[model samples]
Target: MGNGGAKFKFLSFSGKFRVLHLTWLAFFVSFLVWFNHAPLLLVIQEQLALNDQQVKTLLILNVALTIPARILVGMLVDSYGPRLIYSILLLITGGLCFFFSLATSFEALALARFLLGFAGAGFVIGIRMISEWFPARQLGLAEGIYKGLGNIGSAMAAVSLPVLALWFGGDDGWRYATGITGIIAIVYAGIYYIGVRDTPAGSTYFKPNKSGGLEVTSKLDFVLYLLINIPMYGALALLAWKVEQLELISFNVLLGIWAALVLLYLFQCRKIYSVNTDVFQGAVNRLQRYKFKQVMILSLAYAATFGSELAVVSMLPMFFKTTFAVPVALAGVLGACFAAVDMASCPSGGWISDRFGRKRSLAVLLAGAALGFALLSTITSEWPIAIAVAAMMGSSFFLGSAAGCVFAMVPLIRRSLTGQIAGIVGAYGNIGAVMFLTVFSFVETSTFFMVIGATIAVAAAAAMLLDEPADTMIEVLPDGTVQSVAMH
Candidate 1:
């Protein structure tokens, strides 16, 4: 396989580029609907008369289910193919958005927002879709472009939703604006279904050998995979603890939730073992194995990068309003500056990974992200607001790029398992958000930024241990024929 290709023409909406455009737009709609309430959160709080604790709980609930949803969606996309799975996901997200927009009580709103977390899993679908359409040499840039443009949905909500609420000219204007996102999601679901195929003509879309859990090649990896799953459930437990702290749930209820989480973990371990029973029996071949360590390192990196992005973006508009005493609309625009840079920076990270090497690009970008967050931590109310915004945009550049770098390697790990691998990595991103947001609930804004910087710095060091992906991966056809897929 060659490491060169024709220059990408992103504007041309023909061939694979057409799939790229449509697929990314689907992801964009998912994010837009997922976060429509964020910039307008204060408005919702005022209209519904929510307390501070309830407001913070909304942020936690927004990302809590995404951890498990990504894992489940990953398995489904791998089994059914991205085309069908993504369409169904968007349709479901649209309904959830409508439900959220019509919420008449905090309980209803909380339930809607928690259900909306599934939309975040839409990202995993596109990772597999893009990997099918684009080759490895261009995979990084392609994935970067997909995620970069798609992620603009959150920034768009930040910048537009506030203005949109004002335009609608009523206390319920926020509802109208949010409902519009739902309509867009539903309309696009049909368009995405018709506009894209799972793979190009005459190409095969590979499926995992088994379903329910990610397959591991070795016994040690099986154990590591099980151990790695603990944090996901632990993150859920953390959320339950936070709810208990809010006094919404009793201590006894919290204990029950924790107990259920333990049982869930044990059940998942059983499914994982069933999926990779061959590993225990010593029947898996060497060439068929990929390192589970790659998944672990990428998961950690994503938790810091994308995870921080989720936590920060969710809270940033409010952060600016309170810290610098800016108006809501202006604060939203400033908060958007954090995610706006994704358009350029994400692709830049992917291009860097493509031109250089994946391991090197991720490590360097993560290091830069740590430094960026460190600079952000120094911001105080005394500082000029413009400087704070500059520091935030600078930090976002590194964070978004690091996210691009993380997904760039996900598909290359195992072609057939791309969706599940992307799911695990993507789930960790939410896990990071849950952990960081939980921290934010307890600490001051500066402390929150400082904690993220420290976590990301540690992930940067671990990135060095990542082994570069090999030139090819072997997969089995349904007919039992062995096919060697080229990575580059």
Candidate 2:
């Protein structure tokens, strides 16, 4: 827990610590509102008379818009600063929660959930704000604390929302429960706006030179950037296909969605070109150059780590119940241990990255995650349940740690591009979930675990190619003054 030269204080309410507290709280409220619907799905379905297919569609729609929303929000965070963007996001998404609560029809619920996915994008906002406040040496721990604690919002919603609903008592209890979270978000939006600044006094907040797409230093990187965007669009198309499989949409409608995706891809490519036209002209200075492969490798590693976490969390309870013959309630509690470990494991991973070398820490953690999953694949009916649970927890620790390590390196790559970098990496996490869950649909639990293990192993090898971030990065201030920002 090195805090550059300053003593690290967890309870302090001044300096960077205050900003960290406020920012993570903002993120916490966003996630709380984002997932408030999940635990109440049963009540929602019953009250709205939703069929099984409609319920599943609501689930899919909840995460559907997050991928693009993160990218769009990241660009805005970089352009306008996190303070304003975060406040507004919380304000608007909070209102959407109210709309979701009041929905009297299936279509209204679907639309509200889809729009509420934008709340997931709030994670990217704090990455930039924290990076601006903390020095490179302490960034991993700061970010780990921010994300690790903030992430608990989902777990909190799962635990508390049901209780709150019960306490409210009645058919509309779930609605009141959901609406309370929205009220909290709306209130917090105001607190966050008045409580925090984007950076410390006398520090500069750097903005990207171009707006529409990520800036690339080389023509090769320019091409790589375009190629990397294909999977994001593909993931959205996959969601549409899944909806169609549920007979929620017509085949013709699915084709229309795919066609629109292709067009959006082309439009994004044009934006990428516009942002990096300087690369084509050979005008980017050598010192100013960074390898886009860093972004690519981090994205792949994140997809494997966080992606598997999302997929596993959704299915682990069912796997436990069926494979081990555990009671439903017990299986769910046991399964939640996977996500519950994030509080400690995420910060430990970031602390390890800070104490050791970033590349080595990430590669080893990813490799460990692969091995952990491989061990998980060996679970069977005859095996002791305690051992199985231990294996799952062990695997969860590695997966969470690897995720922390991935973001630990994100802000270091390019200061001005941190938001976009975090956005792309964060979006890949959702893409990975979509891909792995799709695989699970066609395979057994053992096979699903094996696939994730194998994918992470490949990412571990790729992690070897990542260049260590430099000791200092150069950024241009709005005053046309070149400044050096410390990394370590």
Candidate 3:
């Protein structure tokens, strides 16, 4: 890590940087394809002659599958490896894009968009991939670069898709714009599959000993795992409520969804039992006893950090427009500053965690984020627009940093289960989004900020329970001998 004297060359394609660039590009394209319809939503609305509620349904469906998809993909990536999973997902993304583009009815579009949430799972896969390639010392920085730079794809989609549509011209221009993203996915999936490796040659790619659910070390952890999973299902239930209220789906379907979520929750409990049943019989070794509460803590922290990011990013444009009484276009530009700052600030957060300490960095960042959001709550019509924008940017710095810093701790906990850990933590982000947005629907903009601000403060308090990562963690190599990796 002291190799700062030798500038870390990003252009080198030989080692970790190659994997970082390739994987981030994969994440980048996934986000772009996932959000491709967003920029073109207006055109689609006009073409399909859809009502406002239906358009909102499309937005809801865009993220509906992601919470569960990340969990499923995490298991698959840990089992099969990211190279295969990512390539497969990208190919499917291509097909979904094509399907959405050719939709002749709202059902087809909604179906395509819902299925396209699978693309969001790509982020989890690349997290596993990057963690596999980079050591803990460089992990935060590497992940920050991957995610922060990758997140730009959404902004790029916003900026470029509309222009692409205009350039293509005619009513079908949106279709072509959407289809081009699909084509990119199809082509890149091939390249990624052919080029990427699960791990550096001769290095064992560790897999969890049991496959169905995350392995927990103790009975209490088992209970903690089950308790934590409740919110994910609740998030799905909330989504069903939103869609049902819009009359996008029948009440019978909503009932069926609730039943299915209950069944899935029970099934997950069984899986948690099936995987960690030995914990009830025997004591786990201290070397192996990574805290399940760590996951719980990180989940809450992520819900505050990334969850708030998703909710706030979605709301910022409207919030700014309404509060400032500015042009919609100008508000959009201002809103975009949140994401624009992410490229630098996210890396800064990770760097701060790496240099200072993960627990301290996250705690400070979360507290800062809470304060930033609290300040945002104080913003009023009487306030100058520039002052308000500065407060928003200040929050973004903390929010972006907290997002990057969260993953900085993930790889060091346990190498084999990083994907699953990442998955659950990532799922909470979506859960947080659903929860925050659901509450936002019932409250004012200022109330929304206060709610998030309070939630983050609560998460920060919980974060105090997080123990710093130890000097080393043990992972079983493919040869069955445990290998020790440095944590700090």
Candidate 4:
């Protein structure tokens, strides 16, 4: 059999299967740590005597640092390798979690939670890790499983943390719930470092020519890459504005953060040009060059898909409780369907891309997600509660599948820069969430759903702009010989 036709043996204890299991477990724990406070936030708030605004600030801070951290982590993953980066991230995240559990003041809790956002960067690491172990033909399914199964960590956090807090049954019970996740992460960090390899034996691990930022193929792409970076920093600026508006930080502090972000953006642009400076010199070969628009388009797609998923899942329980007059527990269960459905939807989305086509599959799923959200916009008290939930579940399936389809294409875009590309895409997902949630602050629930639908429609158009993956991509082997890896 050709190397491209790799069949994943899920039951196997060795080879790529072992790598897949290990990497996804690492990702799961990262997410588990990342969202550990979410379910127990109420208890944490009560114990700490936090007001509503302070609670909101914690949520914002949780994701605020993650946007920029993903970009930095992406570069690190490409420059180093997933095995090392993942271990270090876990160790750092564990320490932050421990710090958070010991917090007495709001300042300490906020700082720890903000820094813990780095754990979310673990997802991009697995994208690079799995892409290394799996061949092109199986890339989508493998990545889908990594992303999908790992996402279950968020749900697990929601379900287990609260229960653990109750079981511990005290004012500081939430701390124990949060702290235990740290111990688990620290233990597993060592296991992952010991067990995982960057790549299988004899396979060359590819690195970017320049590690500062992404390398673009054309002048237009360079311009586009710079323009695309605005939203990432802009989202952070928006967070600062929100916190300032809340009076959580001094106005001058907010201004300083804004200034710092501007300087960082300029520095990043300088790095981008420096890294890809040789592109204009005709130093890059045509066969090895990949379009940067592919990155931009996929980033937008992820912003709408996974980004919308993040926004919706955050608000779904409250939406269900108020609209349907359901009990909180029932609403929680109903809302969870959006995330719970990822198990099948993500893999199915990837498998469809593998079987049929990537661009077409994403476009179809995005369009379906649009329809799902559009349907959600019209639901009201007059609508049957069951039917409304079913619509939400249906939309979730589309959105989840579209998210899977986005990753399906991420690995194929440029293999060596898969981590960086995943970083950009993943950051956009967070950007989308921040924007959607910000919009949710003013808009009604139904309107929020409609806005997401509109976003997905635009992303569908962008998906059409993507050039389908060619049958083969050229990669350099360790001995300097080139090989054409199968794309399908």
Candidate 5:
């Protein structure tokens, strides 16, 4: 009970569900702040006198740090626990948003944007918190609702923030509008810290076997782990290079960034070795061993699935404006449809995963997504608007379903290391987005969709290779006591 980390017993369904509502709302609020700039950037750009390259730089910086931030925050959540980490993250992001609002120049705005990327990492914390409260059977639906509903904030921001900027009026109105969002973030962080508990009563919380490293069962796993990490850091390096191309970061800073990336990769490799040392010693027992190939496959699947969705959502509105020759506002509204249905379909994906088989449902979802995106690539200016809209929505439906399917397997992968696993997988999703978007910067719209379609097909193939979930996964409680948790 000391330090306000109290363990309370869950006596009522109302209490547990209330926790779910509050936790998801916190996530919702974080996302709202995270994406508040996207819709209002047009206004900010004109007001600040920023050119196209500068604006693109801001966008790149906005997501540049998220890849590593997710991994670092994942470790912090697993070590210090989510209750404290999530609250602090909210507060820090709020402060950064406030800084972003007051920026007077492109450089200051870019710095704030890069720092603000950390908000995207907040999703990893809730994965652990939600897993603690809900049983395995319901975890998918719970996580789906949490992520799917929370994701709506971006769409909502796109719809409302423009109008909010107008309402404030005058030259500096955009700043005030963004400031209000920051204030909401600060207020909610305090509320969450006071209101939430990390775990339900009469339950043992699981922690990773070691701190500061991801445990692997074999030497090959250690090597595969290091190989998989390259892209995550590389994504950041790519962002830095993009910024340099836009003149956001100077040439010297770019070289420094490249050097830092090499060092970080080396450090990561050392950690992988540290975590897998027991496996090399032949001290890992059968109960403690898990297939690392599963982790690698899921990471690749997530990169293509969720990553493509992130990249597509960022560019689809612009594509519609150019291809369909529509008003920017209308194009944005049409693009919003891609994410809008997720609020419903994600929960449906989770419910379906729970009722049917986990692996089978995920495979079906991935297959559907690949086909949907491929169909979407066939759309052109010659097509009717209705048909195009339907195609895009279909693509998002399958993508959202696949997102639900991925997290449906996240908690089931390794019960104790759920946060770290979710973090790595989530980082791959951002890495996918960055890599795909970087590709989009060079390719045409039709080609962009085709590239994404091909990526999804690859992920679908990986989904076919994934092992099915079983009845249970093993975890060790704090007292060094092992327990078997249901995977249904």
Candidate 6:
């Protein structure tokens, strides 16, 4: 239904191409809004006279909801189509952005920041949308390009929003600058809703039969699935604990939230069993069911790669300033080089996976990442800045490439469940970020790097377990019509 031969082919002429462009544009806008506060946060801190703890609290609040949001959004995307779900998300997120911009008090800003976490759900929708449009042979590279390009939204915010605030040129300049990005988000919401479809006009858009849980194929897989779900909720509980430590909420409130999360877990498990009732009824052939192990492997892989990348990037500026003895401004540029590598390597990694073998490419990249982070931990201020830069580049290259490798396998697992699969995998990246950052908070910087390096080594070994995608996957569409899709 889509193009042939090239995984990185441009989708400019096809209707699917338009959908891809518009959908990614929508995602890009969501991200731009999502991170608009980051670069401008310093300005905000001065304006509001926030203590360092309050500033840290705001940063924590920004991503706190995203862990659960991704999981819930994945469920919603599979149950509803991307068109309606994505559009509403954009609208609501834009409103939150506007609210944040207009906030005059710390409390108002905090609430607005929390609501903005929903925008992080944007990634899940496009994973499913791109999977629907592209075939298996190209899914890895296609999804990689979509994710890589859209992810640049954070970089865009870092580079542009600060300048925008300066150009606006007043005490209130930041507000106007952020508000403009919000307006762009609102406008794009309408554009995407009208411009995109879940699939081609004649192509069937498959949905899971049950609304609340992931469908599993076996008792063992179901148990594994439940185990995988734990980290998702545990990540949420971790965030609640963070809020409590920051005194943002009371201990009792945190406990109540934790209890509610437990109940939610039970309800979700019930749904998993209900939807996967067929698993116990019939003995399905191996090829007929997706491997739960694959999901686990990719989850760990992303936790190490994208997860570590997120953690490193968060602490990068400070790492560079302290380790290399550079000025704050200079250190920021050096830090960016680490992230800038993603611009090229991320897409390249996907292309490599599509052309080379998926597992081989991932294994090779993860090995490089393990080595890169290990080298990073060995650096000292006495070393040349060039040497440090080289090390950071090495780390970023593998991280970006490994991200490409992880997603290359995401869509291949379950065609109809691509959103949920990508969601869970994506959530792991966020979890990695939180876990790695928390470790960084307690340990020396060198130890933090070494710990992440060790984590990547274990993940690299797991990469060996990933099987290259098979030739075809059979999906029963909504009308109970069977279809076989090609895999590379």
Task: Give TM per candidate.
Answer: 0.93, 0.98, 0.97, 0.96, 0.94, 0.95
- What is the C-alpha lDDT profile of model 3 across 228-292, one tens digit per residue? 99999999999998999998789999999999999989988998899998899899877777888
lDDT of 3: 0.89
lDDT of 2 at 463: 97
Each prediction's whole-model lDDT (CA): 0.90, 0.91, 0.89, 0.89, 0.82, 0.84
lDDT of 2 by residue, 1-488 (tens): 11346566778988789999999999899999999999999999899899999999998998999999989999999999999999999999999989998999999999999999999999999999988888777888788888899999999999999999999999999999999998999999999999998877777779987899898999889989999999999999999999999998999999999999999899989888888888878668777788899999999999999999999999999989999999999999999999998778888888888879889999999999999999999899999999999999999999999899988899999999899999999999999999999999999888999999999999999999999889988886667677777776
lDDT per residue for candidate 4 within 1-488, as digits (tens), equals: 01334566777768788888999999999999999999888888889999999999999899988898888899999889999999999998998988999999999999998999899889999999988888766878888998899998888898899899889988888999999999989999999999989988877777776778887877788899999999999999999999999998899999999999999999999989998887778757788778888999999999998888898888998988998899999998998888888778998898888877899999999999999999999999889888987888889899989999999888888777888999999999999999999999999998998999999999999999999988787865546677776654
Off by over 4 Å in 2: 1-6
Question: Looking at model 1, how many pairs of residues clash?
Answer: 0
- Per-prediction RMSD in angstroms? 2.5, 1.4, 1.8, 1.8, 3.8, 1.9
Q: Once superposed on the true structure, which residue ranges of model 3 sit more than 4 Å away at CA?
A: 1-7, 477-480
The better candidate by TM-score, 1 or 2, is 2
lDDT score at residue 442, model 6, on the 0-100 scale = 92
Error of 2 at 389 (Å): 0.4
Angstrom error at residue 321, model 2: 0.5
Pairs clashing in candidate 3?
none
Would you give me the overall lDDT of model 2?
0.91
Candidate 5, pairs of clashing residues: none
Candidate 5 ranges beyond 4 A from true positions: 1-13, 250-252
Name every residue pair that clashes in candidate 2: none
State residue 35's C-alpha deviation in candidate 6, in Å: 0.4
